[model samples]
Target: MRILVRVLKLLVFIMLINHLIACSWYAVGINDLEREDTWVKANDLKGKGTVYAYTTALHWSITQFTPASMEVVPMNELERSFTIVVIVSAMVIFSSFISTITNAMTQLRNLNSERNAELVKLRCFFSDHKVSASLVARISSCIHQSNKLTGSRVHSEGVSILELLPVSLKCDLAEEVFAPTLCAHPFILTWSEYYSRESKRLFLAARSSSLGAKHELFNTGQVAESMYFLSSGAMVYVRGDTRPARVSPGQWLAEPAFWIKWKHVGHASSTGKNCELVSLHCETAIRILSQDASTISGARRYAKTFAAYFDKQFDQLSDVWADVEVLQAMVSEAFIKHEKELLRHSVASRVVKDTKMPGLLRRMTSRFSGVSMASRLSSEEGMSQDEQINLILHERVRKYGVDGQKRREILGTRSMGSDSSDEVLAPVVSPVFRNPERRQSIGRGRFARNGLNVVPGIASAFRIMTR
Candidate 1:
């Protein structure tokens, strides 16, 4: 489009120049003719009113000849010169115009041909099965042709990289370079190396079925063998007596018994209407983790730095698993040895202080002693006072409002003035020091005492030993 406009502009310029030259030539010729006519008229006027009888047949008489009475004679030579000059100038201008038009048309035709060839190549590539085989060759040929025509050697490898880079990254990188072609060359090499490494790693690419029916309580403790990555769905993580937490995409859920020596924690179920997940076997994941320590470390760093990026309830559990694995790799140890140091630092930082009773209370409540505590709280017999308090605290912290005053209210703490002004009195019962009786009917005893039936009675016996 721009080339066509420039051609039209050039033609207009040439015509203007030709018109000016023609006007100048005609003006000069007209001036010369006028001067000659004036000289002829003056000479004719001088010879007016004077005539001598020269012929025998004519009587002697005086003729009154004025300027107007003199007949004007045609100057054929001057007229011929003017005609020849105009014709020659016209021919030269016409030839130049024709040449200009022809050159512009040729350029347009060449551009159209190049565009058509590119379109044909693109269509062939899209339809052909040999695209992978021929792509490199086609790119190389195109680059060679372009460089030859432009008289500049372009880097073909760089062009190939730009073609392969994802559009978003390519656009961002393109703006950073002054000479895009040259800069793009090195970037292609870098990208190729990185891509080659990543292509070797295992990835999950599987379809998931719809979770239509409500599931009965699943004993995740018994089901072990696989690790699941939330590829395009959300899940709720229900652990012990605490409220379920949500887990979304990019989070990985591994059964503890399969990966580590710890007891199974909880089960995960779909949170979204239609959940699609990618399941990788436990052994496969462990093998990858063992092979690529750097990948594991990088994943951990990302999770820690962008913890808030995940809104799913299972995010913390996933992060803890990831962090422990990375730290284990970094320290080259089987067990985490820095727990005391971390606690000390937290106390020093005033994140947890002895003087602040609530902080101390929170520390006690959030502590996870072992699987025993978890099993005791989750069983049908219900939780002990300490277990219930721990579960409540876990729910509060998981919801990110553990420090709210409403928590203290739920724990039977009262306002200062209200406690003093209250006039309500309660009867204190004395403990009867009687000998313990052996229970015969275990079911009736359990129901009468704890309001629940005894089924193998594990929850009642699993009590926390206070220090």
Candidate 2:
């Protein structure tokens, strides 16, 4: 059908061109009418009178033989009418052709644009998909190996710890820590079985460093080849000799800017207290993370979540680390599984009476929910060393049990009251369970105390889970 339409259009265009050419030829022939009076006078025509009379009679007869009335019309008037009709017809045809061409061109442009956009979107989608798939595969492989190790009688707890530690740190502590924590997790068991036959092994170890020690700091101006996780003491983050901030045990350094070739923007120095640190090289970490697409995707997702949590906690910890009220608020709000439900139920009317609450609560609830969900997923799937460390610091406060809570209380109080030390260290507790029901109840109770209700989406998610 399309081909036939194109053929018809082409034929019409050719016919129009031929008609125009014929019109042009006729116009050239008519130009001689202007010079007719100059060549011969009307009175000096006695010899040609009879011939002229015959010629005029023949012309009249020919004109009278036409379909319409043969009244003699002025040549100029007839010519003018013919020219106007031809011009109007030509204009109509030209306009129709132009409009058709314009519409077709517009459709073609739109199609091309859509195709290009789809291509771009497809490329990005596939890239992410592939990464996600690879990560899953690597994790699966690691799990399989862990299972085999578990089958063996060797202590698997150490292997598990090794799997969690970064490559550089693993090499440093293989003899001391990695061999002991092999059976703690399934991942550990798998790793042990895989490396049991090998003579060389990897592990992580920490040693205390003297305060004000002139230890080499990773140059922030250069690309970070490794990341450091402080196990004990403190390290000062400096910008050219000026101490901007101090990182203590359980805190991590190094931004996840390696994917885009990012360099550190500042320098770090040891605060010289008895400090223990675990360092992981960047290339090894990338290689490990990139082994599977799923793992990478999982890590990336978790990274965004971790960053949010860190930023929030960092803000609260800026002046003092011992503010108990701040600590409770941070801990309680860390997971959004409950808070969202409170907000959802609170807003009953379809029409919003309070405009500010909706937007503000929605954002806050999303951040809380998103971060907690990301962390839970990351822990289940396993993550890179830096990510694991950050997760432990931010989410593992409960590991220390009563002691941990006491330490947190002290830090909170100190933060609210005094600045005795440049850096403060405390173990953050990880929540016992991520059950939606439990979270919802907690969130609702908190909201009731504050005189707010849960939002709809959060309420829905929670209600569905509870049922």
Candidate 3:
């Protein structure tokens, strides 16, 4: 549509330029109409109609643009000079027009220029090699058929462009682009309802690929490296000589390869001109699901859900048990499903987050870190002895009331938490002392600075031992 609009614009520009040139020629004819040597007199346009005069002028103007010779000859010096001017102007004007068209074409081709460049390189690579022509043709055809653009496009370019994005954005973009395809799957439709984030990361880790018509994705007995999701196009699963089952879009192939070591038991191939499949490698699958301990259990739950989904699709368990092998398979699948659910629950119950002290409780407990109230208050640092005594008095009178028994209980709580042998003592008198004389009146000598800063718990224990 853009190219078409540009072409239309160029055409309109051409018409406008020609109309002006013709008008200039008509103006020249009118300027010297009476002169015998003038174009109007020499062409005998005065005897002819206005249409004839204009047509003659337009013809002369067009002759300068194209390779054709001019039909009307220049009559005099002025006419010859004007002819020279028109010819010179035509060169400049035509060059500009040619450049505009060339640029527009180049811009149009730029869209597929990357694809074209790769094809050219591929052709050059095969130029000297004596490879089969059929193989070359098929390779080229597949390149054109697939949409593997090698990250040339990104902003809304689907999940294939995720390699350029950050880990977080990759997960987010994957969630947005592959969610519909994932949720469309019968197994995932229910599975994702519980583990949506894990499902998205699983899609992120998957590598998407394209296949041409009848292209064998994997042959029977081929070592399986990836579990495939048929995002688009039909696939044929051929096991031994049985009828090839047509696998539709939004289906899984080699699902067991995702969780365990496995090999292809069937051949899978594209059915039409194109196929797009996203394969989650066993390594990548485990990495995505078991990023944390929580997700490990979630992965088991996913396997359990997937198993149950397929298990319900079969006929009654009794009917399938008619064959001994079928009976064994059913029992094994049931056991696997039960074990997965049981482990998922068990693992979830066992994940214990680190237990740290609560902030409020820690702060409250820290207030009783020292032996006596004053020494305990000293553990906080940056306070004078008088300030410590004032703080205790204020807190006791304001919050605990004037009861000495409650104050003793607070002291006991502090004593229980304190290790006074290792703590510094900062003794404070209960009654505020204004002078040295007042402090000395307690009768206890200067060295006797117990003041409840001693080991209260040890003393109590010793008293108990004596009893």
Which stretches of candidate 1 lie above 4 Å from their native place? 1-201, 204-210, 216-218, 255-263, 291-467
Worst 10 residues of 2 by lDDT: 458-467
TM-score of each: 0.23, 0.25, 0.41
Poorest 10 consecutive residues by lDDT, candidate 3: 458-467
What digit string (tens of lDDT, one per residue) describes model 2 on residues 350-432? Answer: 22224655443333333333355456656665564334333433443334343444434533322211223312212212111
Q: Provide the overall lDDT of each model, using Cα atoms, as 2-decimal numbers.
A: 0.37, 0.39, 0.53
RMSD of each: 28.0, 30.7, 27.3
Per-residue C-alpha lDDT of model 3 across residues 1-467, encoded as one tens digit per residue: 46658877987887777778888877776786567777777778888998988778878787888778865877778778888998898899878888888888887688569768887888888887866899999887666546443322233435455467787888887777667665554444433443456677776765667676778899866767776777788988877676777888866777545433345666888886567776667666666554433311334433432223222322221100123333223223212222233233323433212134322222222232342776788877687544554455445334322333342342222211122341221231221111112234222212111233322111111101000
Best TM-score among the predictions, by candidate number: 3
Residue-level lDDT for 226 in candidate 3: 75
| Candidate 1 vs candidate 2, TM-score winner | 2
Candidate 1: lDDT of 329? 27
| lDDT of each residue in 111-130, candidate 1, tens digit only | 87997898788668766745
Put the candidates in TM-score order, highest first.
3, 2, 1
lDDT of 2: 0.39
lDDT of 1: 0.37
